[model samples]
Target: MASEAAPGSIGGAGTALPRHVAIIMDGNGRWAKKRFLPRFAGHKAGVEAVRAVTRAARAIGIEAMTLYAFSSENWRRPEEEVSDLMGLLRIFIRSDIDELVQENVRLRVIGDYRRFAPDLVKLVDDAIARTAANSGPILVIALNYGAQAEIAAAARSLAAKVVAGEMAVEAIDDAAIERELDTHDLPPLDLLIRTSGEVRLSNFLLWQAAYAELLFVDTLWPDFDAAALHQAVTTFAQRQRRYGGL
Candidate 1:
């Protein structure tokens, strides 16, 4: 990772550099294992990678970035690991809000807020509020988020609306379904990158990424840097995004 991130190594030619980049950050535990360190240490180091990627994206003129910080499936992990992640997130919110504001970056979280601790939830809300007016890149963190759950929730909400006489059952369409989703106002993803050599989507952004250019890399989440991102972007640039048709 260190060798890859050395100056003048990233953002090379053929980098498609999509306006919106969504990442499924993976492999923190594996990275820790390789280093013979605790998994929590990998998570901590991943924070630094997050900062680096955000800065790199901003510098490279990307408009939006969505990171899969924690998925709904992650609850199955050990309690200690989950607790450590929550702690790290709270600290990240407290420590990074000012920097986010200063950089004109807006912070958005897409996930089940109810699952987090009350204090952590409040801190996240506060951070979002503090950065709400920023005009730079929009940084979205998916905490406790799952596309399947989002779709189910949207369907339930739509069903409720139909029952309440607010919307007719026959009137519900794709647009209505989208409006019911948490990502209703966000742009569709242009590129989806997964690190740690993982080729699977792992249930991240299923709907939004339907038309996105997908890229996978061997670099672990804790080690992913500007160079890794540049590689993904460059690969994205090389592909012709047909969007399901020629």
Candidate 2:
């Protein structure tokens, strides 16, 4: 997790890099267990990894990054762990919003983030609004987000539109459904990475990642840094994307 790692290691390989990237930040608890520290410590360090990866993206000229901060299924975990996660969310927003604003990174949330505590919800909204006009890199945090739930919500939205005579049933298509999704504003997903040797998507961006190249790395989330990101992109560069065609 070297902070000073150079971003040029990724973008200068001559092969194309993904315009948009999503990460399933996994293995924080395992990382903590390996170090004999509480899981909360790993989550806290994972926050720094988020910062590092965001910086790496900006430096390497990537477009957008989406992080799976917390999933809807995470509520099934122990109450104290969930509480620690919420607290870390508060601290990350309050402390990092200024840096994000100054860096011209637009912040977006994909999940039902407003379901959190009123104060915390306000904090997230304010932070988002503060960075709304940034023109360069984008950061999307998926907190309490589930792809299935998002898709179902989008379906309901389309159904309502049809009922209101705004859209014909025949008008429903892949593009129409996509426009109703939380990631509608983002460019098509180009790469999806899961750290800590995880090989599954775990309900993150199932539809958008339909054609995106997948990378599962062994590094834990807390230890993933710029160099690791560069390595991932480099690997992505070497693959030939057929997009389901020859």
Candidate 3:
């Protein structure tokens, strides 16, 4: 694991960057409402922001970036809106797969896919398979994910092991539970950013973000750009991460 240096530690040329960064993309509906356009329009524009940010993260040397794309709670949205969002996801995958491949960016989806439509699940699987060989930074998309549910599932899995005598109940530790989570293979989360002025985690990466520095920006998801990402990263580089130590 690549641990971050203490605050104010300068690297060879510039400030050391976070190894892993996660984002909560928010305010698409509000952006569209303010512009007197349908909410779906904002979602379409948000896709462009995702592309821009992905390129920016890769350029800035971030090892991994996780995006809170669709939440498990999003199923309560209006039928038409949900349909539109799903359509946008498909379009994004199809249109951007080539670029991602060329850039050596690996696409990984971390969420429960059993509830997704078969075709949508297939598209996700295909995207992951296609990018499996990429050596560059990873782009993790959280679709239909809920942090509480994920934690409960991990706990249940461990409980089953104890019941079957496969593991001792007292042996359960932070590291043991982390291995069962969806982000097990990714780098430790270093920074978490929420756009549109939201200051809450909103059920995103609850465990992984335990020690991550949080940044809240007022920019809507549709309006977010590389410059915004750069600013957030620059701010992150200046913060001290004590992790309970002085």
Please list all clashing residue pairs in model 2, or write none if there are none: none
Worst 10 residues of 2 by lDDT: 1-10
Q: Rank the candidates by lDDT, best first.
A: 2, 3, 1
Q: Tens-digit lDDT track for model 2 on 180-237?
A: 9999999899889999997899999999999999999999999999889888888888
lDDT of each: 0.85, 0.90, 0.89
Model 1, which residues run further than 4 Å from truth? 1-16
List, residue by residue over 1-246, the lDDT tens digit for candidate 3: 112323233222378688899999999999999999999999999999998888877776788999999999999999999999999999999999999999999999888965888999999999999999999889999999999999999999999999999999899999999999999999999999999997899999999989999999999998888878877878988899999999
Give the number of the best model, judged by TM-score. 2
lDDT (10s digit) by residue, model 1, range 195-221: 999799998989888788888888899
Candidate 2 to native Cα RMSD, angstroms: 2.2
Badly placed stretches (over 4 Å) of model 2 are: 1-11
Candidate 3, clashing residue pairs? Answer: none
| Candidate 1 residue pairs in backbone clash | 15-234, 16-237
What would the TM-scores of all predictions be?
0.91, 0.95, 0.94
